[model samples]
Each structure stands twice: as C-alpha cells, then as structure tokens.
Target: MKILIAIGSKDFSKPTLKLGMKVAQAFNAKTTIIDVGEKISEFSSQLVELAQDQLESWDFDAPGVDVLEWAFNYLSQNKLIDTKQTETGFPKNRLIDDGEGRKMVYLSGTACEDVNLILRNGDIIAELREEVQFGEYDVTILGKSRKRNMSHDLLQYINSSLLIVNDYEDQKFDKILLPLDYKDGMLKVAKYAIRVALALNVGIDIFTVFDKDKSQKKGSNYFSKIIKFIRRSGVQYSHEEKQGEIVEQIIKKADKNKIIVMKASDMSPIKRFLKGSIPLSVMNECDVPILIVK
Candidate 1:
C-alpha cells in the first residue's frame, strides 16, 4: 500500500505524523511525508539586487534534501523501520522544485522498499492535481487543523481515496462507522475500511440506513458479502441493518470519536445526502476524520 501524508505547516498536526506512521506500520505499507514549504509571491530585495539582469525567477527550497534525510535517519536509528506485518517496504525519496516560488521537502524510502518521495513547488492543489491521479496513489493522508479541512479544489477533485486527519486522539479508532447503501462500490469502500481497521486494531461495524421493505433483501445480500470480506481480512467486525433516514441515522449512530469511511463516487444515496445538505456538512459537522474512498 502507498500512503501519502501532506503537511501544510500553517495547519500541521503532529497527530498526522503519528497516524501516518501507525497506518503504514499496520499495513506494512510505504509512506511518503510531504512538506509543502512557504510560497514566495515576490522576489526578495537581496535576491533582486544580486540578479539585477535576471528576468526569470524560481522557487527556493529550504532544507529540502537535508531535512528529510535527517528525519528518515531519525526514524531508522530509532528502529522505527518496524511494523507488525511480515512484509515491509518504504518508497523512494525525491525532492522537486516547481520553480513557481514554492518549495517542498519529501521523506520516504527509509525501511520501506516500495515507498517513494515527491517534492513540488507552487500551489499544493496544483501539484496534487498533477501527481495524485497520475501516480495511482491508494490512499492520501493529510493533516488539517481545526480551522481548515478538505475545502480545496485538489482534495475535492482527487479520484483516489483520502483520509483527512483531524480531531484525533492517541489510539481512539475503536470502531469504524461505515455508511453503506448496498451499492456496487460497497465492497471497494470496505477494502479501505479493512486497511484502516487492521491498522488501528479496531473492529469494523458495517452499517447502512435502509428503507425497510425496499432494501431488506438487498441489504441482506450486502451484509453477506461484507461478512465474507471481513472474515477473509481476519479482522473483528459486525454488520447491521437499520431502517430510518440515511444521513440522520448515520450521524446519530456515529459520534465524533469514531472513524467514518465512505466512497467518493456519485452514488444516489450520497448525492441525495450532500445535495440535501451543505457542501460537506456530513464531513465537517461530524468533527472527526473521514475516509472518502475512490
């Protein structure tokens, strides 16, 4: 598995680092930590004076390779190169300069064999748009402060699964709230939930708000498939059917502390839920990290 951890220094969260590592270690997946440095809108007086004849300007990267190297070394020296899984790999490290007056630092490929790093300049969203889809990243984990979450074009438009890290605690993903509608993507969404559940050593509660008569049979088949998947995953889990309003039941059943996983596709239920509500109220109001699968 490949995991991307993005750090916007202004809203950087230490929990993001911890959660990234925990997930990586749990799945024995490679993790890339991205440090999106500050942007320079204008050239500095010293730089301008030094290169008076120069018309072109480029992004400046600070502590790019050196900083990431130090961090990777720290993790290795501390024997952090370990996970519970038998397989382990770290992606390769890369430093990139977009030459648009923005810098980045990438960390990866320490103990993980498949891990890779990437550094980009200019806007974070622009870089993501160029790389995330093209690279086929399985999951992207990002740190969002209380003041900010997934409100940008990059996050909103990405096709891969996204794990927004926020309002987190030290090991509190006791149960994952999976809101399903017995659709084709349910299994795909469950795949991600399995990864998270294993990573956190938590139980999976497969749930769906049904329309009673219309969904009972389909819901049964859905639960049967989900049960088979989770059993194969060798993780503790349970499936239940509820009759009520979908979003309301989901919100009421899921507290702020539980991890909620959902797919990003334009499913009918999800579309109805979002259009009936604000832009991302189900995500924003929950006050918890949401895993939106592709």
Candidate 2:
C-alpha cells in the first residue's frame, strides 16, 4: 500500500503527521509526505529557481524546505526512518525539482517501507489530486480544513480513499465506529477498518442505520457476511442497528472518541455532485477523524 500525507506546517500539522504515520505504519505502506506551498505568480515562477540557488548559497533553505526538514526530524525522533539516514540529517541538497513546480527528497524508512517528502506550489486540491494520480496512492491523509469547499472538492475529485484527521488525540480515541450498509463495496471498507483497528489497538463498533420511513431490509446476507468477517479478524467489536437519518445517526454515534470508517457514496459523480452523499455529510459534520473508503 502507498499513503500520501498532506501537511501544512509544523505548528498546525503535528497531529496530522503523527496520526498519518501511525496509519501508514499499520498498513506497512510506502509513504509520502507532501507540503503544498502558496502558488507563485506566472511572472515570478521563472525566478523561483534562481531564488532557490541564492538561498542555498547563503546557507538558507528555500520555501517549503523547512517543513520537509521538520518532517524529517519527526521521523528521525520517532525512529521511523533508518538510523544512518537520520544521522546524515535532512538532505536539503538532494531535493530535486522536476520543473513542474514539484521538489522531492527520498529516505529509507524503518517502520514503513520508505518515506518521501515532496514540496509543491499550487492550489491545494489541484496539487494533491495530481500527486495522488502520479503516485497511485491507496490512501490520502490530511488534517481537516476550515474552508468548507476544501472538504467538498476532496471528496468529489480525489481518486484515492481519504482520512480526514480532525481533533485527533492519539490517546483519546478508543474505537473505530464503522458504519456499514448492504452496499457492494462495503466489504472493502470493512477490511480497511479492521486494519486500522488492529493498528490502533482499538475495537470496532459495527453500526447500521435504517431510514425512519422504511423498515430494515429483509435479507441482509451481505451484512451478515461483514459481521462474520469482523468476527474472524479477532478485533473486539460490537454491532448495533439504529433507525434515523443516516448522517445524523452516524455523527451522533461517532462522538469524539471514535474514528469513523465508512464506504464512499456509490452514486454517479454527477448525481453525487448534485445531491451530496451521506459520507460527505458525516465528514463535514463529525468532530472525530473519518476514513471514507472508496
């Protein structure tokens, strides 16, 4: 598995980085940490290279280099990266620009397979979308943004599964609140939840919500299969069925102590765009971290 972690800065992104790395470790994924910097104007873009050269000559790192260095330090302090790599320090000199507004440095990892740091200049969603496409990442992890549209765009456009880290405190979370349905792709979502639960040493809360106007489905063979899978995984879990608005019920049960894992909407892109979806609503409304599996 490959994971992409998007971070903004050392001050605001500590929790994001912390939780992202833990998830990556859980999956033993090849990981990349990306910092999307403010976009440089078209007129000034040509001079970016020259400015970088001048900064390096003056023993100063270029823009976004500090964030990468901070990430390197975090890996080294946590022993996530190889000891020899940590001893040599952050390889600022090795940051290679691909002439496409992207710069990257690679490092050997101890916990995961490898770690990469990338710096890009552009709109956040565009840069992230391009990176996810280029890397074919399995999951993209980032902190929750205050910009409302950011969440919508990420859900609508990003190709990979998403983990939105909101108010994440390592020791505070106690369980994975997995909301299941009889959808075709729910099995995949359940597997993802199981891996995360094992990684975090947490149990799973298997929840199913039915509409207020409609009774529960009669033959839930798929739901039964999901329960059997979870039971065999050996991760402690509890199952419950509820009646209400799907989004409201999910957010209410998630509270702040549980991380939510649920399937992405199966609606067509046009339909989802026109009328939103349950996972998106839960993502926007819940205060806890959520993994929207695709």
Candidate 3:
C-alpha cells in the first residue's frame, strides 16, 4: 500500500513523524512525506505569514530559518533524509523518490500563490492534492485538526482509505471495530480489516446496526462470506448486531483505544456532502481514529 503523509505547517513535529513512520512500517508500505511551503512576500520581507494556514505565530525569516529549511534540517538531524539531499540548497519545488526505496519519500511544493493567482498559478493545497492523486496513494495520514477549507476539500477528495492519526500514543490498539452494513464489496473491507487486525494482534468485532423487525436470516446470510473469510484468516473476532443510528451506534460501542474501520461511500462529492452518509457522519462525530476503506 502506498501511503501519503502531510506534515503540519511544513514542519516535522517529532511526534507526528514518529507516528507516521510507525504506521508505514506496520503496513510495510511506501510513504510520501509532503510539505506545502508558504512564500515570502515583499511586504513581509522580514518574515512570511501565511493566512492560508493561519500561521501567524511562525516567523518565516529568510537565510536558513524557515519551515522548509527546518524540515530539511529535521530530516537530516533524524537521519530521515540524507546529508546529500540537504547540501547546497533544497529546491523549493522538489519531488524526490529518495532512490533508497526506503519507507519514506521526500516531497515539497511552493504554497506561495494566493487565491487570486490560484487559477493561473496553482496554490499549495491544489499542488498537494495533485501530488497525492498522481502517486495514487492508497491511504493518507494527517493531523486530527485541519484549519483551512481548502485543506478539508483536499481531505474529502482524497478520502480513499484515510487514517487520521489522532493523538496516537502508540501503534497499539485494543480492538478494531468493523461496521458492516452488508453492502457490496464488504468482503474486501472485511478482509482489509482482518489484515489490520492480524497485524495489530487485536480481535475484530464485525458489527451491524439494524432494526429488530429485520430478519436475522438476512444479516446472517449477508455476513456469512465475510465471517468465513475472517475465520480462515484465523483472526480472533466477535460478531454483534445492534439497533440504532449507524454513526451513534459505532461511536458509543467503539472504545477510546479501539480503531474503527468502515467502508466509505464513493458518491459524488456534492451528493455525499448533501446526504451526510453514515461514514461521513462517523468521521465528524467520532473522536476515535477512523480507517475508511473505499
């Protein structure tokens, strides 16, 4: 699986980097680390203040002390990026494969353009989104909080199998909650969840929410394949049926230590927003990190 990781404000918070690295190693996946650089304007020559990221507190002074410079230094300090990559000067717009075929890729794009110039000169958000799409990343890891509307749009667009790394103390998770509604392609979701569950060495709870009036036979028939798949994988799991709003049910049942894995709807963006589908609802309402498989 190819994974994309976004650094907050183009800076490497050690915790964030460690968390992303752990996740990449867990999946044994190739990872792309991206940072959007805010440009230095003539008016703000002393420092660059990006209103886009609401980074007023940060002083982006020139000559070795900006976030971009900071990123390279951090990588070098942590031995994430080679000293060669840091020599001379780091490029403003760079796409490096790193050649090592290691777990992480180093990427940075200019986030200097304003909204008025976005059409002619693409902005940072657009550039970041484009890179992720170009890489066809299977999963993207980002901070729990995203400030800008454009950042949110990027998230929604690239919502395919997202793992929002919220307060990740460790890679450890108590259990994984798989919310199955018996939809098509659910077996794939189940298998994916099972793989993760196996990796985490945690039991999987294959659950569904439905009214009592509905026939148990239908739920049993629908989940039979998925159950068989999980059983074959030898993943310890329990199946449960609850009755309530899907989002509410999952949130209440999912403990703080549990990671929730659910299948996301691939409906059109506008349509999905209007509908506020169960997955979206869970994403907004639940405090737990969600692994949405599309």
Please identify model 2 stretches exceeding 4 Å from their true place: none
Question: lDDT per residue, candidate 3, 121-220, as tens digits?
Answer: 1255565556566678777766665444533454467734776655555555678899887667798688668766766678898888874556543655
Give per-candidate clash totals: 10, 0, 0
**Which ten residues in a row are the worst by lDDT in model 3?**
112-121
- The Cα RMSD in angstroms, rounded to one decimal, for candidate 2 relative to the true structure is 1.2
Instruction: Indicate the worst ten consecutive residues by lDDT in candidate 1.
Output: 84-93
Candidates 2 and 3 compared: the better one by lDDT is 2
What would the per-residue lDDT of candidate 1 be over residues 1-294, giving only the tens digit for each residue?
767766554334456666766677666776766655444456574575356324323433243344444444445554564332113322222344446433343333434534444544455666665566656667777765344333434346655677777767856658888877766657888887888788787888877677544646454576578779889999887777789766666767677667888867564544534453322445655666777776
lDDT value for candidate 1?
0.61
Tell me the whole-model lDDT of each prediction, alpha carbons only.
Answer: 0.61, 0.92, 0.60
Give candidate 1 misplaced runs (Cα > 4 Å). 42-78, 81-114, 145-155, 211-217, 220-222, 267-279
Model 2's TM-score against the true structure: 0.97
Distance from true location, Cα of 222 in model 2, Å? 1.8
For residue 146, what is the lDDT in candidate 3?
45
